[model samples]
Target: MITKEKILERVGGEEYLIRHLVPTFSSKVRKKNYKSIFSEKDDKPSMSIYKERGVWKFKSFNTGHQGDVFRMWADYYGLDCRTQFKELLELIDQEMCLGLNAERKSIVTPKSIFPNSPTVKDPAASFPSQTLRIEYMSDYESFISRLYLKYWLQYGIDQSVLEKFDVKQVSFLSYTANSGRCLSFKYFEKHQVVSAYHISGRVKVYIPEIAFSFSSDPYFKGQKKSFSYKNQNKDDVFGLVQLPEGNLDYILFTAGEKDCMSAYAHGFSNVISLQSEHQMPSEDLLRVLRSKTSVLLCCYDNDEAGKNASKKLRDSFGIVSVQLPEDVKDIAEYFQRYTPNDFQLLLGYGVQQVQSITVNPIDTHRVRRLSNTKRSKVKSYLSNKFNFRLNVVTQEREMSTKRNPGLWEKINVNELRDNLDRHGFECNLDLINCILKSFFVERFNPIEAYFLTFEGNEFDDGKDYIRRLAHYVHLKDPTPFNTRYWYIHLKKWMIRAIRTVFEPEGINKHALILCSPKENIGKSYFCEFLCPLSLIRYYNSNPVISNEKDAQKSLIRNFIINLDELHQLRSNAHVIKTWLSQRYVNIRLPYQEDEITASRIASFLGSTNDVEFLRSDLGHSRWISFEVESIEYIDDEAKYILEKSWEQAYHLYKLNPGSGELSKEELLELSQRSDQFTTKSTEAELMVQYLTPSTKELGEFMTATDILRYLQEIVGITIRLNTKLVGTSLREAGFDRVMHSDIKRYGYFVQKGLI
Candidate 1:
């Protein structure tokens, strides 16, 4: 009898036992985490097992229970302690007995867990004696009957090829004195049969009714199935044993064993086949081919599934596809009709034809013309006329304006060369270089290309520009404000917008927040007018800006990040603040493995219908607010004014690019005036409604719990409120607190005052 320690040592370790047993216990397992959530229909193991220290441990998250590998096995089978131990011993003994071979002569531990271990001698002696049995025959008549030989000859395979591969007929179950015969193909590893496939000769009505059985079948006999006796190192590629042992010039890959045999009969001795079309060749087989062969040719059947598999193999290993004649379906069928010499000639002609047309000719002048036209248009539009840039940061966002194709069309050298060759033009490197130099401008600093031009008209003066823009803005939202207030802010915004295209330097960066409690107030339209619709990146709602990584991803390729109909931004207000203040940020693209430090070229602009959008800590300096009160539809007159205003602003911006800055006193005063438009939190508004300035003399004290109860019960507020949130809002609204002791608990004393 083997002790527990001896059993563990003989089977390598607990990890080996679990690895070999997991598939038998669970149907589905996640490769990344090795976690399996089993179904209740069968006795499945619902847990994740992993190696800890020197032992294997498992934990079931569903039940919050943990144990070792032995316990897991017992739990899975509902076995008692004595029976479980007996079964474990039998498993180890079976593995050691089957694994014993003449070459190694012992079962060595796996290299991953135990690197240094002295080999135990005579492992086969520890279990019941057994031997592998193979019934060899002398010739075809003695091996398979004449009927079997005829059946195989129908597929164009001769008896000599079958005898060379050692095919035989065997019987598994018998009903009469003479048992029914089935063809058996032994799968060999190191010249020893590890498994045998038994193909039945019984005919069926359906095309897929060819039944087969394996020596490794679990239900072959009424006995407990164990994986320990199975072949641990089976070859993925079938028919590998028949190939000659030397370097091969080429290897033909087929989809089935019969096809491989047919190819060999057709004088292609160096051929291998996958078990099925879906089963790709293993990496080890591919590596051998790469070392010994120069070319790999896939000869799959001429069906949709076969063609798809051929393409998959081609993509994986850069192998070439060998096309058969349209009349023939596969290698076996082709061999039946044509001679071996004829097929060889056909393959040679195909290879020569492919080599002759290796490089395609191109039209150099056409590519040069397309590149030049695109580049000239972009430069003239940005430098002279007003053209907008539209930056798409994510797929979920839909921009209101069309994307500018000219700005994004960059020239690729390799693509240009290929196009030239296809169009029959001789490729000239010097000519391509000249064209590229004319179109592409290199920037020394990241801030060189700061602004994208708005596609609009030119204006005469700043005053006329402001009036036309104000009329256009008024057409969208007719809420009238002080004339001077509207003029100064509108003028400042236009200057900033124009500068974004020209000289975007030496300015305090603040995100423009266009907010109002009402909807359809033309806030988004106003932003569109200030910058080109093409140059703006639009987000329908607030993005989850939880960390600097998220911020970098969102702001990498845009000039203006526009948020529309934003309702709330309480969670990541600080991250947004950092994004607004930094002139440079670290960016990492999805495809790139490393991060790149680049200048922050994009500005933030957000429109919201929520009155309580910002948290208390988001200071007013990083944001500029404008309230849109009412909206009106644009008529012909307003449209004309808008067009003329855009023309005026375009000319004004070109004449004087750097003109959008306010004095410190003016900025401070503007901030104070904008504060009136700031949104107040619900708690802050409640404090203002309930507390009076004269109530400070009353000097009332209340516990946080009592205050919470009053807010929830008396006020009938449905939202869950905690003391931390309440206190934060009250403090932002300018309320002072003092410590107070009650009979039951200590609380806070608050002097009521209007905020």
Candidate 2:
């Protein structure tokens, strides 16, 4: 009672049998050249089935379809073909019987075993099925389709069997979003047609690629950056890219590599960021959108800074900033807060993808520091206090209380003058004027005049001023140059400038320091150290601080200058190189005032950016850019030999000094000789030796974070730390990369004396 349908279930169908069985098992065994399972060429399917007492079974396969030729191999091998067939069936069930492919034996109770039509006792179980489940070596649409078309008769859903696919049943799955592009499936229900999912109203996230290594550890933590820090493949992400030739489009930038990854999952193209090396200019983005005209939409942060940056980018890209309701911020929020219809209206169909910018302006500390209202107060306070006759100018542009444009020098000088005058003693205007007029060299201190004014008095005004200056210097703004040296120098210079206020050229000689309330909030370190250092120089009436030859002193100045710009910088290495290489680069000085006049003290000492530019210009002559950790607390008691510390430090700087602006080549040579001075481990030639990166310390300091914290401590930034959020503090301190390393190093140094 073997039936045709029953046979077909196992051997595919008539087509499969004719191509494999018929030729190998024709009427005559000798004529058909029949071979046994042991025969060299017995792999023909004609003899695939075992026959004993009208019973048949299958044999295990050799490589691919070996079991299909089980009988032939069995007969050739002269073994019990039935046993081989049974063994093959068992193996097949174990490997492929799971899912819908599990075999359904004949309820067909075969009625005959004739050649024309395989006999079966019954036909119900023999009838092919309408449903089927299949798995491929990989998820590939074409491969899935090919497997179905080629083997349809076996699954009972082939076109010849079922005739069509029930497409609605086709569903895809993946661990991540963008891993579905390679999936393809179709369904066929004997005489019925199936409809696919409707695309009219739904937003489908399209997966552009499927290439991810299955991770074993479910709780694995990812690297903080966009790229894999260790053992990462480029293919880890589904890169859905828009070609450059697409030309001109308004680009909306977002945040995080994952955000971009998710958008790519949706198949929307044109979004790009740090994922690729080629940075598309705003003009280029606009150019592509020219043909397919559409207003650009920025679904970035709803924060004030985010809005400003979005607007700024829109302007640069020649696009309009689509305003969202006050409550909604990003695309995800747009959906969560509104109905589907509203969301669709907001995000028009067929638009470009979203990408978040990484090297953005807001990330700079200076920008963040200046943006706060209370922080800006410092800029204003100092500005008006310096010069009551003029308004202050600050970089915190949103504040209305910022000083007016121009008159920075007059303002800063006036503030210091007013403070001194309040103490009941008049500023020594003439002596200061004389000192500045004759101060021609790169190095000199004018502070001796102040000390001289109070030389015989214990309640000395000069000492009090120096003390106040020191207190603020301890405030430690990250940019220590100004905090330690320049602030003090500027204060003294302003006092001198104001004393000669009636003299020619006295009105605009110094830069202004406009302070808004809380302006120096946590940024007091710079004012503390740099200002004091500057005082030690300017207050001395000694022509030395500027030209101090202490190898350590020069290095400290270079470090301070670098840290300031580094505050406003994203690429410290690149900026440092440019600075050391003597190339000019524009750095938008963080404005102290929101608005400014033509003649304002935008930067009293100098713009951090300008200072950065000069680092390279004077590399060899002024310094070699040696790396060092900023000192947390210099032993003031041990620091100076009162009579000779200045002279000793000065001598160190003059040792291998070059005159004027030293070239890169000269700097390299000097640094080489300095490091190789007979013994590098002992009695340092350069300060780097004495100031080690704690064998336990980071290469540049107590981890850049601790150094930044040290800087913040000295300068003061209003940062609140969780007792447990060590990582967060390190991140904010700017030593985000090796924060743990830094903290560990710091601890190690204290415990091991490695620094």
Candidate 3:
């Protein structure tokens, strides 16, 4: 039952077992005064048992041959320590079965290679008819030695020169194409050749489908370039990274495309997906990554062959494995939920200008009844309000590959539903559609219609995206329960603004919001509390809203900004706010003109840097940052206290639909208390207080940056202001003048670079 991997690790390999074990045991047993081991006519072992110590058994496919059933003939041929191994393989079926599972087949197999039992993920299939297992340990080498030495003496070793061979010979695999499913090998040492045919002795040979590593090195230094296929056909299939002299950086591999597909789907898109049936070596995959930016494998997942292929592929990218999620079953699914929109958020641009936008939240009666003149006005309003230029790019695509087979197969919705009910999860259809939709909705998440096909590798993203969704939901409601449990807790709170806009009631939108305490608390927690998608989408779309004003809306309609961890981000001495802010806002790669979106945005921040939000981008107005210092929450634990905290946003949204909720005093307090912007000295504070305009005007608000920088300019200077000046409604022609203490000293800080 030893696995192909474990077999190679022992007894040399499949090749060695074929050429040596059978013969080596024969010469020794016969010389020990044992009867001839085989019948002359059939050439199959015919040894008999004496019901004593060291026994031998012959199990082979030749006797009434059956599939994978290594036949057992000799039951208990007793010999002394002279014939231990032959007896051990006969008695070791229980242990071997631990590593691999074979039925009452012709051969005894170690149990590790097959299912621990006949049942798959289904438990009902586990029973005596389908072998069940309860233990898991494989001391392979020790077991090998114990079995071999038990029968080694009977093999008649030449003691003086046998010490090296005395150690259990590890198994090595060899490929043979001439015999279907048969294994064979001949040994030629530095001086002599040893062939075994009639010498197969009392033990029987159990052949397996051969496997090989593509290699051509003189000493098997790398993967071989040639392969053995059906019909004994020879093919040139593997190639290494060849230099000018034809030397390779490493060996290349030959494996089914399915293996490479799983690797790519799991995020290692750098391995070649070959058409060969022979397994690819781990080292070759590592080489492929070094040779290219991306690689993919596409293969069918019919059995263990597929699972093993992916395991080896992942192992090739060992460290990067940590970068992948544990639950993804295959590739297409991984990308399904992590569209490009989420990337920008991770790359540090989820702030004011990186937030999600709304374009005409609802279709109004006016919009529906507009005349041509009014239509022109409406288009103009859209251009000014949303900052988007509309256009359509369309072209009929010509097929470059074979025509899709499914195209010829007619289908209807009911048929699709039936097929999906049985096989859709395997293909990840719903999730793929979601990803496709997200892509079209955001420029940052441009969609690609792949040569769609159903394969196991398509669902890798399901596990990871689901986990993220669950985490978001958990933040809103810590209780571990079903979906309905969450809806109950959040329904009332979500109803305030987002409820009627998401489903039967309304449409829903995606938005990024940041929250923070005065300077050192709660932003990360706040991000968690937002319930990013799942929970928010559920209740908001129920039969909630009852208004004609809500009809003709976008697929998305309302959003909230949550930023409780802002304070925590500010206090970290080394790249603290930088890391957190990077994930929530900014354009990291100025070289590219495309907008950043979603999780991909998170990774683009690289390590750390300042993330500046452009006030010019239409993204600015969609988000609303809340200051923890400007507000307070009543502690509650219906599910989690954070849910109660997030409720404040709904209240604000109801009070003012999009951008007009927080009052003037709230904003002023937030600006003054923000740890990221304040000057430490009282003089600096006074300078900041002196020139500030006392009006709530939009144009004046836009200058807040220059005003803060000016304060940064006058930090050490003495200044005074008529603080009462704030009461006046300042004129719309907004302007500010910088105040200074000693004009001479002011330039000194600038000269010394302290300012």
Q: What is the C-alpha lDDT profile of model 3 across 1-755, one tens digit per residue?
A: 43335443433333333222232344233332222222123454433322123333333322231111122212211212233433334323221222122222242222211122221111111111111111111233444233323222222322211221111122322322111112333211111111110000000112212113322213322211111111101111222211112232222232432233323333332334233432343322333344442222223233455455544444333211112233443232333445433422322231222123222323233334442343233333322322221010111111111233222221132443354446422323453232222211111110111101111123332233222222333222233443333232233233333322211112122123333223333434434334433233211221112321221111122233232222223332223222222211111122222111111111100101112221111122222322223212213332343433234333433444443223456445433323332223442344334553433332233233433445545653344322222111111113343233434221111111123
Question: Residue-wise lDDT of candidate 2 within 1-755, one digit each (tens)?
Answer: 22334444644433333323233443223342233322234466333444345433334343222343444323322334464454323322221111112233432122221234333222211111111122112222443344333322222233321111111212322111010112223222111111121111111111111122222222322211110001111111112123133343544444323233233323334443322211222222333344444445544556665576555554344333445678865444444455546634555531433333223444345445644643234333433433222111121111112354333232233444465467543555443232222211011113323223332333422233332433332322435653444334333333432222111112222222212123323232432234335343222111122222221122211212213323233334342333332211111223211111111111122222222232221222322221122323434642332212223222222332212123466445544523311222111111222233243343443443443344335324565432224333333223324334434543212111233
What is candidate 3's local distance difference test score?
0.27
Q: What lDDT does the true structure give each of the candidates?
A: 0.50, 0.30, 0.27
Highest-lDDT candidate: 1
Off by over 4 Å in 1: 1-408, 412-414, 419-462, 475-483, 498-508, 513-523, 533-556, 568-575, 590-594, 611-623, 627-682, 689-721, 736-755
Model 1 agreement with the true structure over 431-467: per-residue lDDT tens digits: 5444333212221121222222233333345457466
After superposition, the stretches of candidate 3 with alpha carbons farther than 4 Å from their true spots are 1-276, 279-562, 568-755
Better of 2 and 3 by lDDT: 2
Ranking by lDDT: 1, 2, 3
Q: How close is candidate 2 to the true structure, as a TM-score?
A: 0.17
Q: For candidate 2, what is the lDDT?
A: 0.30
TM-scores, all candidates, are 0.36, 0.17, 0.18
Give the winner by lDDT: 1 or 2: 1
